[model samples]
Target: MTQGAATPLPTPKERRRLRESRSLTQAQVATKVGVTRETVRSWESGRTTPRGRKAEAYARLLSQLAEPAESAEPAEPAELAESTAPVEPSGPAGTTGPTEPAEPELVGAGAPARTPARKNRRAPSPARPARRRTPRREPAPSERPGTPPEAFDALYAHCAPYLVRQTYLLTGRRALARESVERAFQLAWERWPEVAVDPDPAGWVRAAAYEYAMSPWHRLRRAHRVPEAPPADPEDRKLLDALLSLPPAYRRTLLLYDGVGLNLPETAAETEASTPAAANRVLHAREAVAEQLPGLAVPEQLHQRLTELAGSEKLDAPRSTTVRSGGEKRTRFWTRAAIAVTVLIVGATALTVRVAPTKYEPVPAPGAPISGVPPLTGPQHMTEHDRKLRQRLRAELSGGPQRLAPVAE
Candidate 1:
């Protein structure tokens, strides 16, 4: 019915090939997807499928150079649903032929030549039950966001406040928490695909916020004055103090699992630890937090307290923006340059110590007998009187005359 219809949209494989044909790296694709380069690789390799907001982003980028996805049309012979038998196409007289497109003549041709009429066809088999499990997790139909970018925005908004709140409780500083949320959102935007598709997107950002706030890089930044901290609630203050008391690993695990509401496996993946280790960290951290609480704190109560502290604090991610590739590249270049400079400075300091260059004049070799007495360690063989006489005679010869002082008798 249409002559100028657009070509069909490229498949994911075709999309990746087109991207590569343009000499674009996975990083470039990731920037558009708001995810890291690795996620792009995963998509291309079929390790993961895009869904939710990620699917939208991917579709948009691919669409820029692609055609519209195919529209509904007559089913082809090979792919047609098997509810009905197939029609045989006309070729030459008395000659079998393959199926062909429906033509006005073929519509009524040869009484709709049916699929090779089989003699005594067997009874149709019953439909198989749906598989209980699939190799890969399909996006939950109910959980999927109705809109594409809306999902990304909704997640950003939802996680922002909690991230800020959680980070604030962790650091006891509102400004720092804000900074953590800002950084986490920026990361989430850059890695939007990965975060959005994650089973627990909220947990991802929460963990990221805490990690940002607790980074060793912030050790020196802690002394700066924050505009606010947790209110004068004893519970909040006590929990913060107790949390900071545990080792960093333990602290992070506890917050991710209990405070951020992540499952133990999710917590382990986020913290980059083994499940057993994460479990242990949570166990010990809970014990430590329990000891610090005012009353007999059970597991449930501890979680409740932590949640309260995190909830009471709030970090509003005021912006959901993605920095440009140029900016990120520039920043990365400078970072690498700074690291190189630091390495050079350290290496120079260690390898090339400054030592005072000493003046090393060679001692004058003893020449023809110096017309002076060889005294002390030079020659113990000569007597003191002989040495004095020689010294006196030498002085007399060098100088025209010398006043002879009375010698000690």
Candidate 2:
């Protein structure tokens, strides 16, 4: 009977708006409910209504999106009818009742044709407008007043070793690991207000390290230009070195998942990647490193060591210097220049001594030779001789002797 049929549902626009408010795309909702995007689209567009379990699921999803309706409002039959409206196209044309073709008998065959059923099945409820759920707000800046400098120092002390270990895993060099970890903390200190608020401070520091490692200037300063091949232990020093050699994104992905012990979802959140993308990054990073260092296996001991290191308090110490904008380049240039100058000075001094003529005494002034002095047998070793020799030798010698002459009798 007509009374047994399901009621019509809301127009599609309402569903779309509700989903949009929850920050879900049609595809996302469809995926959650085991339906196609087109089906969701159709539902939202009001072209059709969902039925049975599908309709129930849509209602559930909508319920999740909205806060529970206030209990203060008592449920009424008319209100119930409005709330149970068909979410999909299951009802008869323009009719607000159930989809059953024939009117069912209530109170025996003698009862009037329009009589209601046993009331066990409630009337189809209408679609109420979805309510918005307010997101929990973070503490106001005024309330937080920022973390104290002491807190930063404490955090640094706790976090430093972990950071160093992560840096080592990425760079595989102790010096670079120290440098990267130190620099990361320095930067963190400078931006403590923001960094401290991050859900995972270690993760943030690791990300910063990856950025530092990937920089062009950092690469150029590497003592070992080519990445050191991975060691037999994937968590070994060599493995860490190889990882540091990888592209920043890959390194970040791997460290977050494998090194940091973050699950796929957590890794996705930390790296700002989708679940699938994060999974792919982890897989590829592992494969890439493995390819280069085939002998190295993922060592449980190394993982434990890194985890222990990360958990230690001493590892958190903040470094004195922060990474300045364009600072790496400037520092590299000056360092290289200093090394070059030192090398040139050393080279020049060696050449001047090697190529310059040996000084000789002037026959002991033909009379009284200075006490303890051995008489010179050759040309006078006067200042003038030295000057002249230097000038002549300048062009001929090109500074230093390439090969020394043997001692003569």
Assess each prediction's global lDDT (C-alpha) against the native.
0.57, 0.54
Candidate 2 residue-wise lDDT, 1-409, digit = tens = 1111243333354355345434467799998888999998788656788888888777777655533321111122333223323343444555333333222211111111112121112322465432322334575766543546656555555556456656655555556667776676666765777776654455566667656754668666647586644345444544556665677777776665545544444455456555556656766776676676664334233244434433331323234333333345556788899999999999999999999879874665456645888878998756987899888889898866788779989
CA displacement after TM-score superposition, residue 81 of candidate 1 (Å): 50
Instruction: Give the poorly placed runs of model 1, Cα more than 4 Å off.
Output: 1-149, 193-200, 222-230, 294-296, 321-409
> By how many angstroms RMSD does model 1 differ from the true structure?
21.4
- Candidate 2, which segments miss by more than 4 Å at Cα? 1-147, 222-238, 241-247, 288-409
Model 1 residue pairs with clashes = 34-190, 34-192, 35-191, 164-315, 165-315
Q: What TM-score would every model get versus the actual structure?
A: 0.43, 0.38
Q: Model 2 reaches what TM-score against the true structure?
A: 0.38
What is the per-residue lDDT of model 1 for residues 26-111, given as tens digits with 9 covering 90 to 100?
A: 79999978998888877865678777777776777776533221121111122111211224455566533333322211111111
